[model samples]
Target: MASHRKPRGRSAGIRTTPAVGITTAALTSVALLSQSAQAAPAAPTAPSAPVEPSLDEVKKKVDDLYHQAGVATQRYNSAKEKTEKQRKKVDRLLDGVARRADKLNEARQELGSFAAAQYRTGAASETATMMLANDPQGYFDQNHLADRLTSRQKKAVDEYQAEQASATKQRTKAAKSLKTLSESRDDLRTSKRTVQRKLGEARALLSELTAEEKARLAAIERKKEREAKRKAEELAREQAAEAERKRKAEEAAQKEREKEREKERGGGQGSSGPDTGSGPGPGAEPGSGATKAAKVIGFAEAQIGKPYVWGATGPDSYDCSGLTQDAWKAAGISLPRTTWDQVKVGTTVKTADAAPGDLVFFYDDISHVGIYIGDGKMIHAPKPGANVRVESIYYMPIHSVVRPA
Candidate 1:
């Protein structure tokens, strides 16, 4: 049995074969290497196609950023004004504090002099002096002298203390105001820098586009401008038509009224009434509102090619508000420096009622301003990189219209 049993246990399956074992091990190792080589990830493939924005999308994004910058510019202007005002107030307060401090020093000196006089006087306790006095008259005299000296010294001390306290309070107030002024100036600088950065980013974005893309964007802008101009023209036509209709109706009504009066007076020829022009004619006086409006419009037109610079109120360049303010200034009208303040200086009127030289504020914050130049057109410093030019009033969201003169 031992000889015939297919090799017991471990020896049964074991091939006492070293060549097969070596061959199997080598094959397994080769298979593993091949598997690993195949299993390793392949090198990364080429990148996917990039998504490009449409021309309109890019324009809108850039316009929104510019609008934000405009808002920041106005905030910067406001902060600057406030900082200046606070600085003046602080200076005044400091001056007052110096005067008060001088008064306090003088009061202290007076008090010290009174104390020295008291010390020099060989004064004793009132009760002790009264007990030591030999006669009633001497005691009475000593009591009166002590009372008078004490009263004068107390008064001087009280005045010095009061003055010192007042001076201290004023100094504290002035210090706090100075700190606030510093903070406001810092905020103004931050706002200005933020506006500059936003404009820079917008410029960079515009520059990054391909030549074809740039052409497309320009074409889009031109198309928008054309559409806006057409719409404005249409509105002007409608308004003119309405005005003509109203004038004809009014004239007819006047004629009818005159006819009734004539019948009551037994019939007589009526002299032609004054010309029913909407405004003063060519013969208008030089100082009339229409004349002033013409002057303002003329000044604005002369600045057509000027650059748009934030916070500028100059002859060579201007901001939106600055242009309007200075143009009105040229017409002998003084407008506030900022759109927010300028808006409050004039009578508010409807957009339809707006006349040439009327100030048109735009955006919810009233950050942008332009002078209406009749015919639904306005002259404005559009934005950074854009020159002052005539454009349709409908180009921006209308906040309000004001007659500055």
Candidate 2:
């Protein structure tokens, strides 16, 4: 669902951070942005080849390519998930078909035995019915043996026909499923190729730069991260102020209610009733489902240093959605495999209201996702060559927030 990220806008009523792929070069190994991290600078160019893009241009191109690759990776994840399900379905169907075929064969054998018994009793003229009929169905029908057939023999005929029909139906279904499975596999391959191509293009662009240019790009990424931090801090401050206002409002309401309760009780000094919704009681979790959020975040945090691998759902490495999906899975929630689907599961929340364990999606396309760990930050698997890490939720433009728990 993700697309080209538009130029950033200044802070508004609510805010989110950058997507993982947006400034991925900052921490990647060797961090070249033809795509990921920085290297050094480029050698002087000859006058004729003015077509070469400037450093910033290269950075933008590389970043765009990586973002595109991230999108492709989601497609791969989708197809991979579909293919797996289809494969299982196909297996079940094939197994059923095999069993039905066996039954059908047994019915045919039983029918043949009935025909042979009749032939031995001088019931039919064809020599074909004397032995097990290789093509006996035609011979039996032509001889009009139904009037002579016993109920058991008739039942065998009906069962043979029914099994044949059922087997045929199931075989067709299995074939359709297999065809779909093959198509899904093709789609998976296409998505994988697209991801590879995008990353390859980004790396090619980065390779053109000299060591110093690469270093400059890395520096820019570092600044980007710093800016992200600053934005997060600013958001945190604003959130704190908002929380304070809400607190004061609740306190005033409580006091006013107490006054009304006092008047009702003839000003007697006694407990009115236990507070209901003024704030969390002692030892209460920050929000409902906070305990589940903690488990999701805890699982995410433990994988912080693992490398990012597209389409991976893992103990070793993970893609952005892969990490989130697995984190929630650890908490006993089964999430759809792609970012697009992941965003659709839980209740949508305002960015400011996002709690720990909520899914934070990024970009208009909904291409990236992270597990919100609160404090205006989220933990995500950045792009290729980058490790799973924590960054401001505003690291990329937030598409929406979801409480996946």
Candidate 3:
């Protein structure tokens, strides 16, 4: 009965034990396990299958290169367009000069023919014809009309002379113009060559960068754009705030002036009131520095119609410094001819202390200048894509302020 009980108890223990039990002996002998007891050798690793690049990877690279090529093509097209435009302008100028030259030559030839005809039918020839006439009385009567013939011949000669002179002058001018046009054409050709070379370089460079790199660069560019836009909006807000402050200041000054006038009128019956001239009051006078500055502002206003010139100092066209010099000169004040020289001609003033007609310098190297026109507005000959015009002070970089002598 004890043997039967032992067998049952062992059976019961076996039944109670779970199937997943790692005995100490099994764990110790894992490294030396029998082949049948071990796992199936990781299924032979499938030989690693030497993977060629995927279709998607090739497509991605191709797509990146294609986009780069497109960008390069677009740049090429833009350069071609610009070159063509400039070439067209040069052609037009040359054609106009040639046409004027041809017209002048034709006019000269026609006038020459008229002069020759008049000379052939003139008084001397007519007198010779009348002397040889069969009727002597008819000859005398014709001779009496010699004075009219002489007058007519003189008038024709004078007109021909004037026309020849004009034609010669026009021809000379046209020749000069053609020379200049030829130079411009050469320049355009050089520009076209340069653009084509740059386009080739761009295309070559496009072949080098990989798809992943392109994506990474694009991400960076987008981030830069967002940052730039944020900065621009911030600058714009600051400008708006400055403008509001100036408007309030002007209003306050106007109110003060009005109140002062009212008090003078109401408080004095016998006193003659302040002299109010439509012209500059006692605050402005010739030779006065501040008054001269006001006149400079007036001079700039007068030249609102003048065209912008890149490097001109002018009776006609002007760049930034050119316009400033001309405006100040018009107001009987002399300033330097260049922006750099002009920068040194005035007393340095803070931006807040800058008044109307103060010279405003701009840019990292001070490449631009403008005359402050009060209330945060300034007049300048702006950059290449712009003209001599009035703009907000906040539109460009403001380096410093200078008050003129």
Best by lDDT: 2
Q: Regarding TM-score, does 1 or 2 come out ahead?
A: 2
Per-residue lDDT tens digits for candidate 3, residues 1-405, read: 356453456766775564335465576677567654765665655556687655345434544443333333323333444455666665666666566666656644554554456567662444334324575345646566435455644454344445545555666665666666566556546544554454455455545658885676567546655664555456456656877998799778777776687687786565475533347745477677678878899888877657765445666766677789889997777886656668888699977666788999876566568898865667887543346777767665588989887
**C-alpha positional error of residue 163 in candidate 3 after TM-score superposition, expressed in Å:** 55
Please report, in order, the local distance difference test score of every candidate based on alpha carbons: 0.83, 0.85, 0.63
Q: Candidate 2 residues 35-59, lDDT tens each?
A: 5334466778867845777888888
Q: Return the candidate ranking by lDDT, descending.
A: 2, 1, 3
- For each of the candidates, the C-alpha root-mean-square deviation to the true structure, in angstroms, is 7.9, 25.3, 21.8
What candidate 3 gets wrong by more than 4 Å, as runs, is 1-282
Candidate 3 residue-pair clash tally: 0
Clashes of 1: 0
Pull out the clashing pairs in model 1.
Answer: none
Q: Which stretch of 10 consecutive residues in model 1 shows the poorest summed lDDT? A: 123-132
- Candidate 1: C-alpha lDDT: 0.83
How does candidate 2 score on lDDT? Answer: 0.85
* Candidate 3 overall lDDT versus native: 0.63
Q: Where does candidate 2 stray beyond 4 Å?
A: 1-47, 125-145, 269-287
Better of 1 and 3 by lDDT: 1
